[model samples]
Target: MAGSAQPSRAQLGSDQSASFRPYVAADQSPAEFTAKAVVIGALFGLLFGASTVYLGLRAGLTVSASIPIAVLAISVLKRLGGSTILENNIVQTIGSAGESVAGGVVFTVPALIFLTPYGPEYFRYFQILMLAAAGGLLGVLMMVPLRRALIVKEHGVLPYPEGAACADVLIAGERGGGLAATVFRGLAVGALWKSLSWILQLFRTAVGYSMARTSFFPNATVDLDISPEYMGVGYVIGPRIAGVMVAGGVLSWMVFLPLLTILGSHMSDPLPPVPASGLRIDQMSAQQIWSAYIRYIGAGAVLAAGIITLVRTLPTI
Candidate 1:
């Protein structure tokens, strides 16, 4: 029964201890927490951080780099030899910090540049760096107290989805295959689609039609992007959540945009931001109006939602 599974008390509790066991044990230590792991992890972290910032600025979303960093660290440490799984874990821990910091800063910092009239010059390097450092330290401090309550006590009661997937990847590689092929297939499909749409420009990356000519629904439009990345995200988050998100988009496009166009059309005066020299709102396309005004409204809504969520969760914290 040595090769058989054992239940984990930390996760499954004493009742299920006979059924599951932790991948890592309490006492069996390996060459972990090393300088080389820290250095290599930092490099991976930096790469992910920069890439995450760019992706977030472009897409208004960011993803955790933990799974990918763990995978890469595992592969590298294995090839280099004389490294333990513990060292690999340490490497990923240090490396993923870059992505975490970048993710936080990019949310606020880039908007100060691109969303403002003054542009990138207004964004100071030292100020942004300090902001990121402060945010990162704050997150670490906050999590330190919760490690036992959430990570240990709750255990399998809650799934750390990204971390679990990364562990699966590591184990799969070591055991010489599992459902990892499915993951590779997904990667191949996504890569191929991106190459066609982005690199080759074989087709429009985003395809949409506007109903501007129709008198019944002026400024009402639908837009869809053939983005593999976004599609994958939607698929992962699942249909219900994706549908809710689509509802928000529908509100912005069908209800809000049309209403704004109608209201603006009746007015003879140019709106301050709309510019006195510019054509009236009737003349402006939905895309133009969205760029000039609607984006701020969307950002405000998101901020409000975040604040409300924080307020609701304060008691639990």
Candidate 2:
């Protein structure tokens, strides 16, 4: 760390005309598209796609497989005795399609059956294949226009985190080795912590308590979760957005619970949903009110906010 030859963060992305620049240079000819590259890329794509399905089902999330796939491509190709940086780039580009398509279909296609009257039978093999195919095609077609503006023009300025990180991985791989190890280190630490928490049962992943038990404030819920991934995400997004999200949770548990109790306890008759014979608001638990009513409202509010943001950004896009 003391006498490192590596360029510091401050020096990156400053030179527009240099070979390090993202765009094509006059002196450099493009890498030939090779058959071997295509075959290898397809295999990695299939592998990542299958793994993504399992991950999405288990964790309800999937990471960008490009960096890891690139690292794997580099390692695998070098051993086969026919490899180049360009081939690695090609492999990553093609393989990345798998995870991207998987995310879109896994999240939406299955939900369509439930959202509609169509049963499981409606979502047959052909239907699923078509859905994924169309979605992938549409994504590619949309990106054709966006690539020049968003990717090239705004290369370093845009701050698209995933794209930037992938670039870093590829560049590091080309330079030598250490950068790829960082990805593995992260994977190891995450697996270790999760194993300690769940396997050993050392501590609850999330510890929560109602403020009514100890504090002057009634019905307030506090939760502390030892989730590095979530906390790191919060920091990356910055304070304002994270604070707004935390405030929403506080409002739901603290303000809404108490307010509902005050308003509903004194009701002359039970609300429409709550039968006359059933328990009143004062009788119901805070969790019941949240589950039955508040959650719907919260969902609608979020949907509205997303729509507003999209509308506001439409002109820029």
Candidate 2 all-Cα RMSD: 8.4
lDDT of 1 by residue, 204-302 (tens): 877776777346778788988868767766766688977877888898888888887887888786655764238677677788777667777777887
lDDT, candidate 2, equals 0.69
> Cα RMSD (Å) per model?
6.4, 8.4
- The best candidate in terms of lDDT: 1
Lowest lDDT 10-residue stretch of candidate 2: 10-19
Residue pairs of candidate 1 with colliding backbone atoms = 6-20, 6-21, 7-17, 7-19, 7-20, 8-20, 41-95
Residue range 150-191, candidate 2, lDDT tens digits: 655544555787766766766666667755565568768877
Query: In model 2, what is the error at residue 20, expressed in angstroms?
Result: 10
Give residue 35's lDDT in candidate 2 (0 to 100).
78
lDDT of each: 0.74, 0.69
